[model samples]
Target: MVTNKNKIPALRDRKAALLAFMPAFLMAAASAYVPMEAGLVLPVLGFTIMAVFFGLVVLWWQTETERQTLAMQLAGLEQEERVPTAPLVLRPPVIVGSPLSVLRELAVSASAQEVGAEIVLAPTERVQPARFPEPSLLPSMRRSSAEEVSRMRLVTQAFEADRIELHLQPVVSLPQGKIRFYEALARLRLADETLLSPSEFLPILECSGRASDFDRRVLIRSMAIARHLVARGSEAIVSVNLTAHSIAEPGFLWSLAGLFDTSPDLLGKIVLEMTQHSWRHLDADHRAALATLRERGVPFSLDRAADLRFDPEALADLGVRFMKLPADLLISVAEQSDGRYAGPELDVRDFASALRRQGIRLIAERVEEDEMVPKLCDLGVPLAQGFVFAAPRPIKPEIAGEQTASRPFGLEDAPTLLRRAG
Candidate 1:
């Protein structure tokens, strides 16, 4: 609308006018120097060119004037209507060295020549965007840090007092719910006899570089339990959770190696478990340590697996005989993707098949509901562990301390032992 109302001198228009003027001026100059007969034609041509140029200029000026008058009338009518209006204040373009500068100068001149226009000027200030106090977690986070410190001190005290106890959670075969394995978890008994679960104290242990110590204690207890089970003729495997820190520590490995050498029989019944993160990020040294353990007949289980993604062949080669994932994760992955792989094109069912083919059994952990069992079974998941079967129970102190003739322990007697134990 503004462009139509304004007679802005365009480059093309200026060029056309310059061209017309050049021809007229040349014709007039030639007429002054030529003979009467030839001069007569030159003057006539010059006159005709001037007439056309004048007519074009008059027509353009008249059109622009009419447009300006109409715009002004519309503005007056709008003002009478009492509509709110903001003055269109044009800012001077920044003086940059280029063809743009020249264009800006021309525009500025044209705007200055514009008549009966009011432009309100505001102070030219660089607007700094609102600086919101950067999302602060510092105050609350510091308090959290202080709380963690206090917890760390308590956990340290517990470790020093040797109040740590071993708790076992059963991993059972789905549909049948037979206890196939028991995952050993360390529970710290505080001064007031408050038992701290792994979820509460494990992170503190890991952060304080005491994870290997906790894992070592857990491993020893698990081995002890495994021996008892094996001696009693039970085929139940006891899985001990180990950390990458323990795996990386030469001292821990040496101690484990010594254990393996002393009680070679315990190796078959004792399975070492590590999180998926630890398994995926195993360094060359970690792998060498793991390989050494594998050679000693100590099988590995991948615990707390975050996803369904797995290379069963690779894991099998790594001596990872068991892969424990959450039951909900399995169902969600299958249902959301319609049994298809969330990351790869392989089917969810095929993953279970592949794991089985590679001798890697898929055990869904945290199966806290009966409904999860059918979905897991449908997905070809072989085993599950959670409160749906049984909450984790502390091993009987007398059983752990038992040194007398081993009471004949077997798969059928497992539940009785669990019930009789803590």
Candidate 2:
């Protein structure tokens, strides 16, 4: 049974409690224990104590902040477990780990997590008629799939309605405040302008073979931003995500080339980002398309990779310029029962060094804590992006100029710079 039920730590963490009180502890000790009338000696002691206090302050911040963030996320997950699912007569095959549904579930879980919701762990016996007193499992599964397809089609209506939006998030260079690159994230806007979580929509979109269309729209939007940045002479690279469907599409690269062939410079400035899963299933057509893009100076990257299913060195050999991984998945000290780390159980520091050898810059995403910044730096990760630095915001039209705008200048740019915020 694959359930979203996870090991959620309690809200309070030990180090966080102690770390919050450290400042007061120091102040009290300084006032009560140190003699104030010792003239020069008192000033020296004060200076020494303040120095020590600040040093420990930095230490405590580096340690407890990430722990607190994890604790908070776990609490949120527990709360999500309480959010009721849409009740249906027959459960989907994913509940039973149906081999036929593996690819579908992969797409769903990735989409769910992208929207900050993990697929909750559930029991495996759901599809058995003996367990639930339902009709034959095969027919029930077919019917549930039909309903799932209906849900996907309804969510996908936004595309036909022209309700797609782009949100920009910056990936900053290490220890430098410079915006090295910006990642363009896809957001679906409704007729009422309300946004839907990718988790709620993307699963079935991928299943329905409509993911390529979505990626194409996002690419067009990203090109508009890239054009604007080039006008500003911004050295910052603009990254746009490409889905597995888009990557494997035989004609997608040709379509993309046609879209930007007029301005070859923009293609050079844009970096297409894919996930490990996206690259995992790449066949001859994907390889050819990627090669053609690389030849045209459109670099590719594998970003937000959680799985170690592929060889990073092999990816680098394919002309991938960078690899970005989520911070939690890349660097966790938590040991599993099998003596593995929470993720792939690789020594991140060493794995990073290996990728670097292949000329791939390792980037850490979703980095929210100050502590992680330095640890990432130590691990040889040269780039980091997350809410800790900046959140995704809408690009202003004037910021990019009309010549470079992907869409017509309209009221859509009305609330300039106000993030659509998914």
Candidate 3:
């Protein structure tokens, strides 16, 4: 009745031919032709490297299919994954001091004041389903594309012309009582003293393999500031960030070694932050460099850790002592499936405890509103940083100058205070 519609001729022809010849080929293969004792030999294509890659892809495809099927089976064991299916809205990272940042803060503040803010935020706070990596139509990266070339040139010129600037944002101890450290965020300084976010240039530098230059500049500047802080007797730490791919760069490591040789005490004071995503690009060289630094008492900080891909145990094994999580993510996770988070959830406290056991501390980032402070405190997050504490700004040029009364006897007054007490 259906008239055998939509039949595939190519498939039908292949099946018929295979049915006709496959048995003969199998019979010949099964029948021992020569009297030689050789067991069996299958002719393999000569392009060994391509063959290996094809085999790996085949294996990977099989493994991934099994994993996905198992995941679906597990989902079936649980109740509906997302009841009404709501999207947990996340605030995009805005350029600090931009009008958009201001409006975003106002909106977060308004929503946070609502009594059911936590409930309003969560669809299911238990576990995030793994998201498939987006596939590309181009199959492979085209590094020689015109747009790519233009961007590479732009970032290259910015580095050569010394347009890179480091802006510091304070990370404060909870209760907004004390400043613990300052995070160094890089920017492109415009003629008007405005800044360009990393989106404007970081990818360009990375694609061009010129990220090392920018990384070196930030490290050198951070080292200089570390030295300045030491001479000024400031106990505060300066946190610097770099792509994981650049961790093993010889120049940056050389500069770091020189700084450590002269100022070994500062090694423990400085914190290096890197995103989890960048670590996926790491090679053996960077791994060795991290191990060396870890031996030298330099602990690393983890950033961009609000995803299912983030494995806390793996991070602990990597000698990470600090993690910075977005406040919204933490808030969203704190709320239960039905938005009933009246008390501290067991999973959150257990997670915080586990990390503490591994000597890793959690710092809630983007703490824009006062409303979120109590939530973070309840969750056992010890430190926070956002517009509420301070925005990204250039630290004063005289950072090494006389200490203010509010600060306890920094560099200039330490000796004087000791003398007066004596």
Could you tell me the lDDT of residue 252 within candidate 3?
Answer: 58
Worst 10 residues of 3 by lDDT: 413-422
Predictions in order: lDDT: 0.70, 0.66, 0.62
For model 2, how does the per-residue alpha-carbon lDDT over 287-397 read when each residue is reduced to its tens digit?
Answer: 777777777777789975765445667787677888888887666732223424445645556667777788787788899888888777776678889988999886663
lDDT tens digits, residue span 291-313, model 1: 88889988888987766677777
- After TM-score superposition, what is the CA distance of residue 32 in candidate 2 from its true location, in Å? 99
Better of 1 and 2 by lDDT: 1
Instruction: Compute the lDDT of residue 311 as modeled in candidate 3.
Output: 53
TM-score for candidate 2, please give it: 0.56
**Model 1 ranges off by over 4 Å:** 1-146, 248-251, 336-338, 401-422
- What order do candidates take by lDDT, descending? 1, 2, 3
> Counting only residues 3 or more apart in sequence or on different chains, how many pairs clash (N, Cα, C under 3 Å) in candidate 1?
0
RMSD of 2: 29.8
Give the CA lDDT, 0 to 100, for residue 347 in model 3: 59
Candidate 2, superposed: residue stretches over 4 Å from native: 1-154, 308-312, 333-346, 397-421
List clashing residue pairs in candidate 1: none
